[model samples]
Target: MPVLQRIVKPKTHKGKRAIVNREPKLIEDLKDTLCIKGSTASQYVNNAMRDLYDLKKPSAALLQKKNIILPFEDITPIENFSRKHNAPLFMFVSNNKKRPHNLIMGRTYEHTLLDMIEFGVENYVSLKEFKTDKISTGLKPMLVFNGELFDTNHEYGRIRNLFVDMFHREVVDNVRLQGLEHVLSFTAFENKIYLRSYKVSMKKSGTKTPRVELVEIGPRMDLVVRRTKLASDDLFKQATRKPKELKVKKKKNISTDNLGSTHGRIHLGVQNINSIQTRKMKGLKKTMAERKEERKRKLPQNNDTDNSKKAKNN
Candidate 1:
């Protein structure tokens, strides 16, 4: 099915500017997720989508209960929705007799379905289950992936990258200790992934750094990995491609080390063998006789400079 494009007739200059700003660029803006609820969405799916939308904050877009199947069956509808909303990432929540409490999480590339990983949500817990204060929306949460499989196994590695891509916010050089309010941990064990959310509590210690503690928040779930449609190597490469402008222009013959020290190679041009006065290197070492000759050579030039200065005065 062909994706339809909607044209807006902007009456004001600001509206026109907004339309123009939405066009594609060399460096795209932070990705917004589309939280979709299928026609057969259960309460568990609804709650999960709500919590995910909270994590994504103002950048998330939602769709009401729609009669739609997942990408594994047919990806055209999913692609259409992605193109219409201009969202690269999506979290689809639905339930069926075959795949109960199914959650399809994936990302799009160039309005096409890139990679879709299906998970069966089990042992679901909602946000209201815990009577703790919720972290403010839009604030970045620290994501921790704790699993040996994440580094060893290829499938778990992909899953780790997906979670990081979904939850990570803009890069910042420095963060305040107080600003770390929440942490989301994805732990893989016993053939299932455990998703846990915690509120960071900072207490006063007798030192400069505060005593930190983690309090259990809600919206937790144990996800059983089901079907997965991974993109090919070439396609995945295209999706993860970075613009040249975004890459730092490297300085020639300069490098850094693990200890964070900047090292550079100094390229020297041809030097005049007679001009060097160093005696440290054997090739440039000056004998006593050579030193005497050098002083004698400088004496005449020094006298000439003094004579020129005197002539200028005259």
Candidate 2:
């Protein structure tokens, strides 16, 4: 009997955005089967594409308008509008230098401006500092909290409390937060806190556990602590300080004057006596000389006498 083979259908697309090819007959069959009307196949294709891409319609939270204000000349904008709208206003500095960007968010315009100054932005003039002539000199588009989705009074207070609580609990407990000597910074996302401490770690082992040994002092650590604030400044300082130097007792040197003492003479005499006894015992021990003497005593003076007597008899 002949072996049978089954035909496999070709897939229309692969990976994320790859183009898919479909049989012309299959497309026509789908249209006819669905009783699609008119030449508007584009709409049907669009809906199918949306389903294939797993895209969902924007929710009310995302659709809501945000309070977008312009920043001062020394400040920059944070393009993450979604995250900005949800949490308390804070400054976000990008880690990437090639795409340098900074963002400030706060409950009010004044609060955000104050934070900018606090975080080392120089020559920043507040709104009051600006004369009517200089009003537009430093202005740029910046995002502020819009009261649509987030209530200014309640939400701002909540965000502030959340930040303070997280800082005290997560950062203070786990890391040494030193005053002036160390810098502590944090970022909040969703319900989690990303706490970072810049201080010398004295741990000697290369493993991940924190240590206090001076030999193990390591570079800065960027840690992600949970929402609960466990870190404290005092605790961190106590843990990371340089360990005390170990004191080793020095060995006492022997005096040359004691070399000729009675005890030393006695020890030398006992050693000499042991050497004489060892020398005497060595003679009594079985040796090659003793074996040669015994062999001569056992062998024949009789053999030579017997040989001489035999020769006389012959």
Candidate 3:
């Protein structure tokens, strides 16, 4: 699809005389069918058409009245008129004006340009010109120079590109998070900074469960650095040694009330000695009695069997 481009009008104060180059009938003819071909194109033709339709009755702001006050000096009558309207101002630091000095505009906020330079511009364009087909509305812009549409070579496309860059720069910067909290880690590379943060809370198992959150900060943007709340247990462990193992093992069976009546270590020691003696002598006496019974029974059986065999042989 052919991209529709827009020519953004300069913002102006109330009741200021301004001039723009446009034709209501011509713009109406090209409203729906043809595409506005330029680098700073927008897909919303509906919006562009609205701005174009409003241009049918141009604002009094673009009237280009004869007398008005401008902020800067060393300027001609044409410069004075352009300054009255919020026209894009292009100036050259050099005398020839061939090389681009700066493409300035009416102060977005006050009576100042973007670079803070307030010099009266050599050339100016009224918003009316961009809205109408009185001038070319394609790759080559219908330019207003000295209050007239000039078909000759001018810096319209370059100025448009510059304006697009200037406006969209903030949007690109805003892709990074506004601020970060509980950042677990961070990294930095060419023209970019990355941050890693954690979402964590105490778990029921007497352990900490951590969730990771990442952020990116700009390479050039200023940041207010702060310490994270999460403590590093590894660092604490490295600094402090483990406590020595306790020699005492508490007996589970002993009640807290009974613990006071008995001396803990002495009672444990006596019980342990008795347990050892009982284990050693437990099976010895039972084995001796069983052996004696077995010998008596076997002797009687042998005598009976020998007599039976002798009788059979005889």
Which model scores highest in lDDT?
1
Over the stretch 1-314, how does candidate 3's per-residue lDDT look in tens digits? 99999966657742222224321122212111111112222223223222222322231122212223222343343244334443322222111133121211221211123221211122222233333223212211111122111122222222232223222211123322222222222222321222222222223554453343322211111111111111134543432234345335677555445446643333333456654645356655458678899999999999999999999999
**Which segments of model 2 are wrong by more than 4 Å?**
1-69, 72-84, 92-314
Q: What is the lDDT of residue 225 in candidate 1?
A: 92
State which candidate has the highest TM-score. 1
- What C-alpha lDDT do the candidate models reach, one value each? 0.86, 0.29, 0.29
Clashing pairs in 1: none
Candidate 3 local lDDT, residue 30 = 18
lDDT of 1 by residue, 54-93 (tens): 7788888888757667668888888888887788889988
- Clash pairs of candidate 3? 18-61, 18-62, 18-63, 18-64, 19-62, 20-129, 21-129, 184-196, 184-197
TM-score of each: 0.79, 0.17, 0.15
Rank ordering of all candidates by TM-score, starting from the highest: 1, 2, 3
Pitting candidate 2 against candidate 3, the one with the higher TM-score is 2
Residue 130's lDDT within candidate 3 is 36
Model 1 lDDT at residue 8: 59
Evaluated at residue 25, the lDDT of candidate 1 is: 83
Estimate, for each residue in 1-314, the C-alpha lDDT of model 2 and write its tens digit: 99999965546445212213221221111100001111222332222222211111121121212233333343233223323342213322221232212222222221122222111111222222223221111111111222222343433334444334222211123423322222234443443323332333344478876464211111122222211212244643543244344334543542235456332222233356554644357557878987899889867786888899999999
| Alpha-carbon shift of residue 59 in model 3 (angstroms) | 9.2
